[model samples]
Target: MNISRRALCGAAVLAATDLLSFHVLATPSAPKIRVGILKFGTVNWELDTIKHHKFDLANGIDVEIVYFAGEDASNVAMLAGDLDIIVSDWLWVSRQRSQGADLTLAPYSTAVGAIMVKDDASIRAIPDLAGKKIGVTGGSLDKSWLLIQGLARRDHKMDLTRESEIVFGAPPLLSEKAVSGELDAVLNFWHFCARLEANGFRRLVGADDAAKALGASGPVSALGYVFHDKWANENPNVTMGFLQASGAAKKLLAQSDAEWQRLAPIVRAEGRELEVLRDRYRQGIPDRPIAEEEKDAAKLYAILAELGGEKLVGGAPQMAPGTFWALKT
Candidate 1:
């Protein structure tokens, strides 16, 4: 039987539609990765500005940035399967790993912390802090704790836990307490440290000074960009894409101040002064992958091990294979 021209055209259209539908059904949708980050801090800068910009819409991968009040909250979320990755401190990762939670390092974000004191305070050095009330935010394996411990070891060889009167409080409250002279000193991240300095607080010692005192040649750094080992292994392409995007964002930030201006509000909220925020950015922000990051990670692991906190992985996790990612040549 001969077909009519109209019927032939209709049949062809139907066949085309069927083929398109089949293709659509056979192809998998892009995966969306949930990323938890600390709210409004250096890590926030890396996440909202760099990591968000990097992985949000590249290679069919979506990176959802979830802001948590602190590292403990972030860890809880990750453990609950709400987050595929966590860009946070290494100490937290070590603790989690010790608890049998599988996590791996992805990248190093920055290296900066300060020993802040009220401008009118008599305390000027580590030794002067004896019998003084220093504030620290506890839980989630705080880097500030490690900083204080390192300082105590170098200055007094006394245990921070037993020798110093360390008061535990939230980050904002700690900064406020230090400013009001309710607390003698605070070991705070850069953002808060900047605010304290702007409000007439003195930065008695900074990361650079600490590194110098410890006879370290490079920046006394902290780790960033952690990922769930299972999620990373299952989605290698997506994970690598996220890393690539983060590296790109870091490169962009390093190349321009305009990027920083655009991201300032996201970073410096919570009553933090803009000038102080800008100064903090200038003091020390790592914009690229550094070899020392691995060494920093190792040092952090050592500290935790000494504290009976967690055991360090001898080498980088198999998923990442290296401490940080490099662009494929």
Candidate 2:
């Protein structure tokens, strides 16, 4: 992560491709790495940064990004050899590995939600959320909400869904409803929560706190870079080079507001909106994969397992020791 700025900036920054540029060449002896990404997910920001800064070319990895409409489609494409790496959760990676689909995970991006409420709302703690209408996206099984549930049960002996009046809706609708006083509070996504924060919504609790209470070592990263282990073993240089480039991009974005401004138009954000995005994003940037040696990692796994049951996380009793890919190891 402490790599030279030149490695991140790359020599080809002068010839950096346009944001919409997708042209990539594959030599007879060197096949380009096919990276799959959701069109609007956080992964897009990182991939776009790599492309706009020419980091891929500088690292000698001929990269071609394949866009998918959603995670399900992206999973299909990865299995069909249409993608070498994809943005996904460690849970999915573990599930795939259990099904004999050799895969590995590396920390890439992390974002956590917040319980946003009116500035003067009386929702001071998790217990206050009880009996109040709360808007939630991703339904009852969203990872953040699940972590909150786990934390509540473990620390406060309260069942959120049973105690609170829960409403499920799209994120934009949830935000609007919360703003208009139609909903008492909104357990919204990080970006949306950031917007709400900028608009003066008070946070009752943060998903990061839930993650901590559930025993994560640091910021809980629900998302990561997943890649085929076979391909990586066969092309170690490309793998490490790609990760190095990614780390540099993370560093640059975390440290420079100018970098956020550069990509603002792409994200359709500016001013306070852009600042929130930048702040929330930098706050969740993960430094490494979870290690079993760490107590928090094991505790988090237990919490997720208890909350999600075997079905949600592919029935893994514990996070596989091989789930993480260490850049140095």
Candidate 3:
């Protein structure tokens, strides 16, 4: 071919490539999605993986991670149109819906707290928690605490909130108290529970156990990517792509030990602590179909609301319809 013809052909090929690739937008900016995450949250691991593996780019999106110090801050950002997504529990989502918010949840992790005890502690069952100092993480409104209360009431006909001396504090602070032998048992978040377990602390009860006892078919997902349903509906492709990237990241983390090694500092563990963290995180990945997940979530919500009153579920007597966002097939 002539030089002019060859140049024209190359230009055509480049144009075609740009058109075929969503990452290479016609505009100057990348297709970006802003996500609000808790500072030092477990969600960071998956977000980091998405960046490391270029999953976002592959899915035709770029993730801009916005960090918040607390769940309330994240929710505020999401509500103010400052963020496209945020990590929160579906129960919270249900509460928001009841309050006139259009939020919905996409599954992230089923990981929740457990009642952890130090080695050689005499506490063995629900009845044993009576009259003992229990460090409860995230205050009295915590789902794990409420579920444990349900477990105790059902299994032992006891009110743990009243029977036990409850000390509500942050997870790290509570974990520290439990370690220093100040608290008899600690009901803490999953990562803290895993760390305690790996460090020889025993699990007296898991949130999953509490959930099952309350009539859930199995483990219920506790945290997920929550966003406004209207926004998600308007940007279906971007929303689906971002969720797909998240799933890809989870699948990578689940299968690759090397990925765990890379995320060591993120999880802040070493030796056996790291191993337990890995196992628990893997165990928490939501494997049930969306319908089944919603069914279990609905069941657990009713049970918790009945057991915990309006505190656990707020004004929402039932899980709002369409609380779980199903990925478009």
Task: Pick the TM-score winner.
Answer: 3
Write one digit per residue (lDDT tens) for candidate 2, span 1-329: 33322332232211233333433332445457788987887677778887777666656676688888887999998887778899787777777777778877766656778889999888888888889999998777677788888878878899998999999999899999999999999999888898888787978888778987666667646676788877776776788667755765676687778889889877768888889888988877764324422335446666777788876766677766556654332
- Single out the weakest 10-residue window by summed lDDT for candidate 2: 5-14
Q: Sort the predicted structures by lDDT, highest score first.
A: 3, 2, 1
Give lDDT: candidate 2, residue 226. Answer: 82
Q: Supply the TM-score for candidate 2.
A: 0.86
| Of candidates 2 and 1, the better by lDDT | 2
The candidate, 1 or 2, that scores higher on TM-score is 2
Better of 1 and 3 by TM-score: 3
lDDT of 1 by residue, 242-303 (tens): 66556445545554566677876676543446656755654344532244554554654454
lDDT of 1 at 283: 39
| Residue 159, candidate 1: alpha-carbon lDDT | 69
lDDT of 3 by residue, 1-329 (tens): 22232232222211222212334222335578999998899999989988877777877788999889888888888889899999898889998888888899877788989999977989888799889999998887777888888888888999988898999998899999999999999999999999999987989998899898888887678987889888877777788678767777777777888889999988888789999999999999877666677789898888778876787777888999878874332
Q: Least lDDT summed over 10 consecutive residues: which range in candidate 1? A: 18-27
